[model samples]
Target: MPRFGSWLLAVCFFVSGGAFAGTTCPNFFIAGSAPTLDASLLSRTTEVCHTEYVLFASGVTKGPLYSAEHLTAAQIAGANSISRSGSWHQETGIPTADRSQSSDYTNSGYDRGHMTPAGDASTLTSEGETFSMANVVPQLHKLNAGEWEKIENYVRNIATQQGEVYVVTGPAFDPTTIPTIGKDNVAVPAYTWKAVYEPGVGAAAFLCTNADNYTCAVVSVDDVKTMSGVDPFPALSATMKSNPIGLTLP
Candidate 1:
């Protein structure tokens, strides 16, 4: 595994014709392209870029559609030393109506789960930014701290082993049901997923149910696209998207 210097490019992002702000922070994506959401689910979406990750927030869903990061071995090593920030707040960069406030999650019976785990932040500021409500979803308690946490740890470990990896994580919601929480009605997702891509190796995704059962499995990237309505690796080959590489689950 090769290592690269740990750095940060802090910027705000937005979708322009399905791409991210005309090449700003291109390294955060694979092949310099961002994911595309299915037409049906592409309304009032906001993209927010932080020091360590990029969040695609959904106005309708009141949570992140997904978060993207390019993790390197040096980055993970630096991140390991950062202290966790328990502070969670609203993303002011997003429109008032499109963002979730910390109060929305108060006693909502769901955890304010991070799409971009704070454990991956390499600095104190970045760690604090990870706590933004824009990068979170209403995740089930069991899944958030159980299998979900395991998956997060696994990805960081792989980043260390592979030198670097592209990670995209988000939630999947049932449009018809649309479970919600709090005064703001933050949407509760049916499932949460993480997709990991090693440059030369292949790609695979982890899907964990956001319910009492809290079951999780490794699935093809295409399966994740179909379920989440987002094509995370648009530049990835069809064969790679169709086939899932074997990954150890927790």
Candidate 2:
């Protein structure tokens, strides 16, 4: 809890080679700080065995603390071609009722949206791992399929073009506003937040509110931190953030 979350990083991440450039899960270089974790929050880190990132699940929201990843150009180029594993399932120990499952949204009108999108995974194994229920949240269908998905693609494209990118993203909610979807009580977030970081280029974010037209606006990382309560990249303030193309999407 020394700022961004060095303790959680040590506890949750285990060093690995290759695309990660020798780092563990819950990478903090992108955030410029490790979250100051709260024991009372009862959050726990669970490695999504199928992908290269990690999940920090919230006991209250019963959703991802935020899913994180480091993506390289080579991986991004191949990520689009891989098919989804369709392997959504619950984590061990967490009560099934507090967890989100694929079945929970069968007819619930929301999308079983991925916090760490399948398209962000570079390999078949990693791509498939993204399907784990730990990486999902009950997202608004249009937001999930359109704006949110567009953000994912845009991040990957930029990362590939400018070396590698580190990202952390997830949903936002109000304690009194959880719209529980299934019998399991998987919560629907009021907003979805995403932060992206490139070492030299700096950090940026998006706040996609759950709505009819979910086109999100490019935001300051500080704005995302204030709203999400998770600072993925602390150094990314409005003045330092950049949108090279100045483009907005549907």
Highest lDDT: which candidate?
Answer: 1
Tell me each candidate's TM-score.
0.90, 0.77
Q: Each model's C-alpha lDDT?
A: 0.82, 0.64
RMSD of each: 8.5, 8.5
Q: Which stretches of candidate 2 lie over 4 Å from their true place?
A: 1-33, 37-51, 93-98, 235-250
lDDT of candidate 2 over 1-250, digit per residue (tens): 2232421232322112111111244343554344432233434333342357766676556678677777788788787677766577676535554566777788998888888888877788777677777788888788887878888888888878887987878776654446887766777877787777776766667667777765466665655544555556544554654332233443
lDDT of 2 at 23: 24
lDDT of 1 by residue, 5-59 (tens): 1100110012222432223567799988888777656778877878889988888
List runs of model 1 lying over 4 Å from the truth: 1-23
What range of 10 consecutive residues in model 2 has the weakest lDDT sum? 13-22
Total clashes for model 2: 9
